[model samples]
Target: MEQTVQPCPQCGTEIRTDRRFTTWCSACDWNVDPVEPDERPGHVERMRRGIAHRYGERLLAEMTRGESPRPRRDVAGVLAYAVALCVHGVTVALFVTGALLVTLGRGGAPSVLGAFLLGLAWLFRPRFGRLPDDAPVLHRADAPRLFALIDEVAACAPTSGVHAVAVTAEANASVSTYGVRQRRLLTLGLGLWEITTPQERVALLGHELGHFAHGDTRHGVIIANALHSLNSWRYLVAPIRNPSGLEVILNAFYLLPFLAVQGVMMLLDQLTLRAAQRAEYLADATSATAASTEAAVALQDRLLVCGPAEALLLRESNARQVRGAAKRDEPGQGLWDRLAAYVESIPEGEYERRRRVGVLRGHSVDATHPPTHLRRACLLARPAEPAAVRVDAAAVAAITAELADARQVVARCVLRG
Candidate 1:
């Protein structure tokens, strides 16, 4: 609650700061990146990060040069699709072989073996995404206002709108296709949603829906299923821990298949890596287009603080647990309200530090996304534009009211965790 002033160590510029937050020189960006780069990533992760950095830089340059960010049908894209097709082909072959053996063997030993093969086929079958059973599902009828906002964002992205919304306790949001019909579903994480402003919420929706508009092959049923099958294969053939003599011999037999699967998986990842980065950049642009460049860039800034928000939630949950359920259910102390306050309380200097850290460490939302700094840069590279879809105070209130019940459910889930 007190302000302090001192000369910056890096530069003798007078710096005014709050005691509650980090003190850094605004003039020279002294101590802008306070955190050290994490050294925990393995060799594979390091390699992937390197690739992401390279791709992000190149794509940013291209976009700055006035090139449209369209998905390229280049050699890597073609090869990746071919590999995905081959992966699916193996699944089909297994089914066909099992069926032939069962039909021709006439209930003999061959038929029994055929049944085993069929079981294996079923085990490795392509998986269509499914809605989480535990998550709170909000249908259009249940949340018309929220769905309307989502539809507005989807229309701005020019993609198919989501069929349903699923509320979760995580600090991230994502869109995916689910079930045999490939219906679009938007997973709205209350942790992130509650902290974002109305405009930033639109930007978040825009970025996710942009994946569909941008033709991100990784999210498609074909490639997604291929990746799933490969992961399953990898899990099956993985080396065992503390193996018995007989198990050691079996592991020796499994080693070749394990190496082969890993090789294929790496190949697929390498082939699609550039395209995935491109899709993310494109999605960021869509976010800017739908919610204005300022809103989109601000959304990225908000993302930098998600770690702190989650930490606050964890700390609150632990304290509440110590106080027992009676204290947790006390009125006027809603989890969402606390989360919003904590996020709003984050200092501007802290955000700048995180932004600089992201630039230094190549920070990303995940392995699949481009570095956040680059995404922010890409949005700012273009001229700032007005939002295509704006959420006024009335609309925000309506949407918030619609999500009230879901918020309580997610709040309980977080506290229980």
Candidate 2:
């Protein structure tokens, strides 16, 4: 017997039912007024066609922009290290040297030193990889299943194979965009693991592929670090000048000059972030293209709702604990804040805030990612998509692509394990 599709309550037409409790009849083009419920196959088909057509234009736009270039593994590594190094290097180099610059009243050494320090702190600040380190990092040779999916995404757009694909847990994932060479790094977090089916995972990966297609996979990282750098000079300087103890007293005496410099850097930071927001939208569009609109939507839905409330809360708490542990291990700190010149020099306001946000928001320095709800809604709006049951087309292409050479290089690293 043929299955009877449910019709919309507002109009008599075939429509897929949803757990969300929202129903509409696409066949009648949605009624101007509510209708009595009825079961009709013809009505169902018509409604289905209507809804499909209604969303079809939007969905197509989202899916066609698939494929992302993989970040070069070395480049990704460099960024991760460089950002951190930039912060430390400039802080020490500038601050120690800045004293002389300040003394000489050199043509703009103070400004130059301030600018460098700002950029350094910005690049190295913590960010939300929310995905854990323990998550599986799929190498080209290892995880044929996952590699096949990536290949398909690349075919939809020009791309080098991803440097890595990881699951933060059973449920969620993130793709890396920054670095020198083309590299895409995926992190599938625990939340993603818990709520989604394997089919959904492929769909989710497709969204990351979308980022590749739109060229959003890498540009923003540089931008984000740059903005942070712009702001951090204020952070680096305020601490050097004020030493944090009594802001009120300092505010009365030196507030004008402090605010003057801070205001300029703030403007620069704002300008940089404004540009970053536009880039984020491009990445979102990429998510829509490589995967089915529905799958993309569902994958995000699964991520937001999957993890327990406690896990979310605990994550931040745990992040704090981890930072404290790291600090204790460092050679200079000596398990105490004895007011060293360097420590005192780093604007105290930015220091603790950066640490807190790392654990709290996931990104230590810049909270660039959009909120969970907005991200989920954007993905969900694309509803109805092709399944992730197949990846053969992509796999074949990957085997022959130029990236095959790159894969071999990464393969050597994986082989060591």
Candidate 3:
């Protein structure tokens, strides 16, 4: 079968393709594939009504034959979606008006103004740019054992399978989809991978893979694109800094209308985006389902401890590397050991203190994930289970061996960043 070449959904690196179940990225090791939504009881109906409710339906009932009753409306989220739709509608209206004005004006002041408006519209048109591919994309051919681990994780997950896998430099693990097709991509940060135990790593992968269960990222991408469009429009129309008096006055005329539309869109986007916190909790449950409640909680605990510790070490390492005290080809084993030691050096009470304080002073309104404390609370409340995922020693060794080149890739990316 011929393969479709596309950017990795997670990191936006171009994928290397062949006849296989999925597209692969050697630059980041992402298994990219589009997984269809499972038949959730009334899910499609619920989503359809959610869209309908956004467009001014008050009484919730199925208009079509054999459809379920409308689900409880999410007023804020629906309103946000509506606002985004309005922005799109308004943008199209502006384009049409501008084109008509330009045609009718025929080299008059109206023509000049219309041409300028058209230029501005072009400048602010919705463009969903790809992310920088700073990680190493991988394939099953590159690491069959590691790919097997992903398969095992997928089997345990509610989702079908992982599409692509990649390795990044951050002390984090995440999953994302790219392009209009919603191809899924999984990214594992080498910093997190190097320090975590095999079981914890499985737990981490489970947490990320768990996102597919709820189909969270699918809608998230839509909301994100809406916000991106609004932001672009806002910036394009915004007045230049320190403008002359007349320029400022002229800019005010241009910006006021753009700001008015963008303001509502921004508000709605925040409301809808904030509601994604529930998805975070659900995804966390999926992780527990794949691994165990204990493993999930332990993973969270480890992240809370290691996140800050990793940052501290990262700064130190970068400084040493900059000063030429560190070697580029020096394997990551020493770096991993130093990270472990750094975490160990912290007092037990200090770890507790950090965990208790939460990761941030307070959660940002735009934060997708719930507070760390809230996540821990939920995990602690869940019923415990023995670790469901077993560590494959040979697989682990092979994965580690394969990542030797990845370490270098990550190092260069990190330093460049």
List TM-score per model, in order. 0.91, 0.44, 0.71
lDDT of 2 by residue, 115-175 (tens): 5644554454534333234434557666665576667666654455576755432224556
Best model per lDDT: 1
Stretches > 4 Å off in candidate 1: 1-39, 106-108, 242-244, 331-333, 363-365
Please tell me which model should have the higher lDDT, number 1 or number 3: 1
Estimate the TM-score for candidate 2. 0.44
How many residue pairs collide in each prediction? 0, 49, 21
For all candidates in order, the CA lDDT equals 0.85, 0.45, 0.63
How close to the true structure is residue 61 of candidate 1, measured as C-alpha lDDT? 93
Worst 10 residues of 1 by lDDT: 324-333
Off by over 4 Å in 2: 1-136, 166-172, 177-182, 217-221, 238-284, 307-417
Give the CA lDDT, 0 to 100, for residue 363 in model 1.
Answer: 35
lDDT of 1: 0.85
lDDT of 3 by residue, 1-417 (tens): 345578877789876454423455555545422333465436534543344233211111111122321223377767876776776666677788789889999889988888887876676565443434756877667777777777777766656655667887677887776656666778887767766778888888777877776655324555565676677776767777889999888788878767775567647645654355555666666677667877788778777665655585568567766867346556555665666666555544344545545533224222445657667676666566566677778777888887777776766555434
Provide the lDDT at 175 for model 2.
Answer: 64
For candidate 1, lDDT tens digit of each residue in 2-31? 578999998899988877667878788887
- lDDT score, candidate 3, position 63: 15
